[model samples]
Target: MTTQPDHGQELIPRPERTPEAVRVALARVAPHRISDMERHKEQALTAAIADGKIGHLRHWLTYWQAQVEIERRPDLSARYRAALTAVHGTSSNDDPAFRSAMNELAAVEAEAQRAVSA
Candidate 1:
């Protein structure tokens, strides 16, 4: 099993980036989102099979894998939601708070991307 470095501390086991793995992780971390996950999986599978291209399915798996990583970390998940709320609460994109919230959201997303890609 592959392990990811956790800030020079003990290595964290990296979950397999597969549909089954994602489902299991979702069950453990976000059980309520399982149906949504299944819907996305079905859509990705249908698109891939119809087009004879696996890109859509692969993209779906990667996206969900990143989401699983984010959800696994409570701090990251909370920060992500808070940043989203801040961004959504703003009336105008021109507002400084909006930009700050967007930056925070992007940073959290980047962390998730690293977690998955690692």
Candidate 2:
């Protein structure tokens, strides 16, 4: 079963960087994305096997490990999306909203990094 952090907790210990771990975490926190994740995994595996290189699979695992950190945290996920929206919605970097959004995005990314590294 997928595990979630207790209320008020901001991080969960980094998950094992494996497809099975990613799949289980996705199932727990982002069930709707499981199909897409599986599809990406299939493509990564196929490309890795065809190329006789493991880089493709490694990239997939690394990318998803960070993603699961955010997906598993509802507050962070909302902040991430809002920051993206603010960044996209503003045309000028000088805009206060844009600056604020950039700061928020950086914070969210930092938190995600810490969660993954923890």
Candidate 3:
């Protein structure tokens, strides 16, 4: 039988090597919105996969992993609040200041699809 390592030992802490966008986004979206965020994430991942953006896939995976880890923590919801405060505009769906931001992002995403096809 093998003994487990010490609790203090570092064996690859979560959110390891994830992009700031993903890490921060996971932290920013509301706890209730996490499921929605995850859905959007899956869409992005599917798009990235279809487009052969392997790098983006890795980032998505890292983001998903971090999200799972975060959700497990008791303070995960608070972390999301802090993230929202830090990256105010990226959350196109929730902000009142940027009324059209969500629409604009949707348009941009659509354009990206068209561009990929073209």
Candidate 4:
């Protein structure tokens, strides 16, 4: 039987291979968003496939697991947080920071897309 490589182990060195922007994006995927998609994976996949996109079960597993390594690294987390705060402004102490940050990041990413295609 051919054994599969443990991708989690293989991915440990991946962040260094990417540019800072990519590293920040990976580290900063909001866990709550991941959870929401996971909760509705069946429907999301069906809709995505209907729209001819490549979404599938476990499509996010690799990236989500990669988050662990990203978050564990102090350098990556610091960069991620900085990038997020820059795009999103600041949240108060009692606010839900991750959600706020993700919303801001999404807006920033969308604006970038618009500018690029304009």
Q: How well is each residue in 2-100 modelled by candidate 3, as lDDT tens digits?
A: 132232332223333345444444454334655665676688778887998876666565545545344433344244445445446555646664445
lDDT of 1 by residue, 1-118 (tens): 3566553322234468777877887788778989888899899999999999999998898888877777877777888999999999999999899999999988988888877886
Candidate 4 runs further than 4 Å off: 1-34, 40-55, 90-118
Better of 1 and 3 by lDDT: 1
lDDT of 4 by residue, 34-82 (tens): 4443555566568777887755434433333345344544544555567
lDDT of 1 at 105: 87
Q: Model 4 — which ten-residue stretch has the worst lDDT?
A: 1-10
Per-residue lDDT, model 2, residue 25, is 80
lDDT, candidate 4, equals: 0.46
Error of 3 at 49 (Å): 4.1
**Which segments of model 2 are wrong by more than 4 Å?**
1-7, 10-14, 88-107
lDDT for position 18 in model 3 = 47
Best by TM-score: 1
The positional error of residue 92 in candidate 1, measured at the CA in angstroms, is: 2.8
Structure candidate 2, residue pairs in collision: none
lDDT of candidate 2 over 1-118, digit per residue (tens): 2344563554444457678877788777778988888888899999999999999998788768778888867788889999999999998999999999999999988877766655
True lDDT of residue 37, candidate 2: 85
Which stretches in model 1 have alpha-carbon errors above 4 Å? 7-13
